[model samples]
Target: MKRNDCILAAAIFLFAGLLSVMFFLSGNEQGNYVTVTVDKKVYGTYPLDETQDIEILTEFGHNNLHVENGTVCMTEADCPDGYCKRQGEISTEKETIVCLPHKLVVEIQGAKPNGGRTEEQTDGQTGEDYDILVK
Candidate 1:
């Protein structure tokens, strides 16, 4: 191949890689609300747009939930490791902050499904349904 041909190939590869990175970083869809669960049970669901402090008091312990600027995070917890406090803020669907010791799970829930499809239209279910199965 000529020198010009090699340069063109390299440029194309570089551009493709840049585009891939941008898409990967932007793939996270904005979440509309957050769900807090304790011991595998739904504790509460809070809107992301509302800024407030929530204290979760379960039999295990307490977790301080904070919502600010459309982001939810565990500001403080009584768990031994304090991992939940370090999990930081989340503002995207499927993102979660778990406190294993307290069995606390804080996860983001997207406002709507992709492609304007409702739950029934897409999966024929009005509520939660198992879709993925591991073989």
Candidate 2:
């Protein structure tokens, strides 16, 4: 290999390493609350700092969510597969525990100043409000 090739390769690797570090640091802000959704509708949003048990009883099934010490997990569930219970704890933004059979989704979210969710967050939309159509 030539000298210039080695320098270019090292520079590219350094840039990639810096970008990765920045993304890791910026994306790891701890989530403040979790939003529970049932059948595509907002069930509720619970704070992570508080210790509480949330019993979600929907027509499809039941799930018991336990929140404590800034983390939340599914303690119990009546779903046939019980996959939600095995998803472990989620305390970072955008992490989720999903129960497919019950159509339930629990996702971590960063809080607003007023301790309430934005329209888009509560409405189950993560990004901008614009819609795109392609035919």
Candidate 3:
């Protein structure tokens, strides 16, 4: 290969590496809050920093969510499959625990520093900012 060709390849590789690093750092940010949704409706949003147990009882079923040490997990559930409990803890943004039978979803999210819901969230809309939507 010519010297110029090698230099161009090296620069491209370096730029790619830097771009990957930037995306990794930004995308994997730790989540400060957990949002619970049932049947596509907002149930509640809770802070991960606080140690608490959230008991959810719906006509479909019941679930126990335990939050501690900045991580949230499904500790108990009445679902037949028990898959949600097996999903384990989540502390990073976009991670989720879903109980298919109960139609319950617990997702990690990054919230404003003041610990208040954004205007969109308060207006009965989700606060998530989607980068892409697929059919």
lDDT, candidate 3, 1-135, per-residue tens? 699999999999999999999998865663488888886666788988899999999988999999999899999999999998999999887788878788777877786323344533533433232212111
TM-scores of the models, in the order given = 0.60, 0.64, 0.62
Angstrom error of the Cα, residue 25, model 3: value is 20
Best by lDDT: 2
Model 2 local distance difference test score: 0.79
Q: Candidate 2, after superposition: displacement of residue 16 in Å?
A: 47
Candidate 1 structure quality by residue, lDDT tens digits, 86-119:
9898988767887878877777777634343432
Tens digit of lDDT per residue, candidate 2, span 1-135?
699999999999999999999988765653488888886677888888889999999999999999999899999999999988999999887788888788788888786223334644555453211121111
Candidate 1 lDDT (Cα, 0 to 1): 0.74
Clashing pairs in 2: none
For model 2, the run of ten residues with the poorest summed lDDT? 126-135
Which window of ten consecutive residues has the lowest lDDT sum in model 1? 126-135
